[model samples]
Target: MSVTGGRVPDHHPAHHRARGRRGGLSPVPYVATTTRILRQLAGDHRSVAMIVVVPSAIIALMFFMFQDAPRRPGVPSPFDDACLIMLGVFPLVVMFLITSITMQRERASGTLERILTTPLRRLDLLAAYGTAFSIAAAAQATLACVVSFWLLGLDTAGSPALVFVIAIINAVLGVGLGLLCSAFARTEFQAVQFMPLVIVPQLLLCGIIVPRDVLPGWLQWISDVLPASYALEALREVGAHPEMTATAVRDVAVVVGFAVLAMGLAAATLRRRTP
Candidate 1:
């Protein structure tokens, strides 16, 4: 008996071919989903401006207005410490802006629910956003470094590698903190409201304006816990005194520890918010 054209014989190759095609197409959806998230992040003007303007302005002010001040006998001069502190502060500012803007916009437009309808994993979404923000932060940090060096006549003692490494770490840490704040914030306004909480405390406690050693004993302990303190210490050690090989390595480790800790907390917070 002849089978009809529409009827497939047992073990037909077409069936298997269709299965393979579907398997291949499965990843396309996920890739597109990730790209969508990244595009959204890139298109946000407030975040873009923040990543560009804040760090650039801070570095410019540090280099031009104060580079000539005399170094105290024992302390690193304000010029030496200014860039280091800026590295720490700039990232925090960038993180706050990006996280606050993105999350708030999503909440306002009620698009977050639509995004959650896809098969895209939560961690993947977080990773894509973090990667985009990190790129912007890295670009800002680099521009700040180049402008500070060229116009302010600031010197890194030819240790360009160290400067790049420091800038990347700062950017990563900033993204992490921003993510954490976004996760906790109920709205964009709430996220922006956290700036004074994150930024002001760091300014007062991070050993920038007031040396950590000079603080009262209890206040010194508080400064020690601040992530910016470690970063400022690391930057000052590397940028100001490139000749101190052993000290630079130790300080870098301290900064890395803070970055890792902030990232870990942010990841945990994201995981909780994902479901």
Candidate 2:
């Protein structure tokens, strides 16, 4: 309980007290909630290091590992391909775990219930979470791209900015997926469990490990339906040819559409305890 001037009151999550006005889908609460998450993230040095710094460091290592490595005349460079895909994949990994686990914690602690008592709608809360994480995802994507292209000598055919944009969109896609997954998890551990189930398949089938063309026709069909495939495809196009082709545009659109769909599913998962 927080000690006020005279009366003792139950403590609330920082997000509940965040800069929200009591009304329908108000921006005040949304911004306040987003700021609240940023504040928590900043304070947690370990998390900041994990989310912001570690991905860049890993990408740098990939650069150094292959900057001068020998390759066959006609063989594909798995190392370089991995690095480009990592720029799109790491943000997804980080955001999915954070959003899923954070939502589970909120539900466990009654934070969601309390927030529902106020004027906040489920859509507003989901948007705040998605917006906040997408901002963080953008930073993560930008850092990975900078290190990969600038320090790591990641050769690319596409413009660095275009690849970076594609990476950011994919990361936001992760945020949406995480939020939807969180609704089914009753604990943080359960949330983490979904990582392998939800994320690993994409890594394996998204044309990152094996080009979809070479995969069995059935597997290629599966990859076509996954959002990660489009993201990886878009990144590869820019890194390989650096063109704004129709294929790249379609993939980008598909990824963004899924992100919106995920957020809508997340909104439906809200606890209807009060309203």
Candidate 3:
């Protein structure tokens, strides 16, 4: 028992209650976690290359493949039509892979369990991760937009700024989905497997191979619910129009809604200890 002001207070009920209270949500843990993640990402050279270099390389290869393909009069070239979708796709895919695998590693290493033992709330941890990766996602989007427009000669009727915004949103969507999926995985290999399960169907059905409307009716219904479908639709809008259209706004809203829902579910899945 400790003495305070000549009175012993260690056994007091108020002291017991104070000790029993869980930590309140605060910005301190959130900011610290975000900073820690950003620093970790910055220090990883391979991850840096994967995030910053790989997507641009893929886009350049696409540019070369379609550079000489003929376009019918008054019709945009195939690459011109497809690359805008790709701008968002590459960021989404890359961010998703990086995030899921990284988070899974944390689970395997027991870092997440240790962090949860402290006063930090699950929302703080997840939100910090989302925010940290969103910053990286913004950087990735900016670089890809610059390379696609200036270096590779990709053309679009919409403002380059709008394309960047769509790309960033897609990347953030990936981050949210990745975090959600990671909770279901026990290993990095399992996390990688989720990509095919989650991403491939969306890619195929998101009007990448054919206009989504022409797909089988059930496939069309599935596409309607996938965020990638709307992401591509928004890209198509930006490519075909100089100003944002009502349809593009709706498409973006859908993607943002999915991102928010995924994050909330991921928070729910977070545990102080995982098997």
- Which candidate's TM-score is highest? 3
| List of clashing residue pairs for candidate 3 | none
What are the runs in model 1 whose C-alpha is more than 4 Å off?
A: 1-34, 67-80, 243-247, 271-275
Q: Better model by lDDT, 1 or 2?
A: 2
Q: Roughly what TM-score does model 3 have, to 2 decimal places?
A: 0.91
Cα lDDT computed for each candidate against the true fold = 0.67, 0.82, 0.89
Winning model by lDDT: 3
- Quick one: RMSD of model 3? 3.9
State which candidate, 2 or 3, has the greater TM-score: 3
- Candidate 2's error at 188, in angstroms? 0.2
Model 2 per-residue lDDT tens digits across residues 19-54 = 354445787777888898788777878867877899
lDDT of 1 by residue, 1-275 (tens): 13576677656886654454442224544466557766776686765676777677877776666856777796756765667567656776677667666755665576656665554445555566566666777788778777766666666553755766777776777666677677777767787788888767877887767888998999988887776777666666676665656766776677667766765676576533322
Error at 225, model 1, angstroms: 1.9
Rank all candidate structures by their lDDT, best first, as comma-separated numbers.
3, 2, 1
* Per-model TM-score on C-alpha atoms: 0.75, 0.86, 0.91
Question: What are the root-mean-square deviations of the candidates from the true structure over C-alphas?
Answer: 6.7, 7.6, 3.9
Model 3: ten consecutive residues of lowest lDDT: 17-26
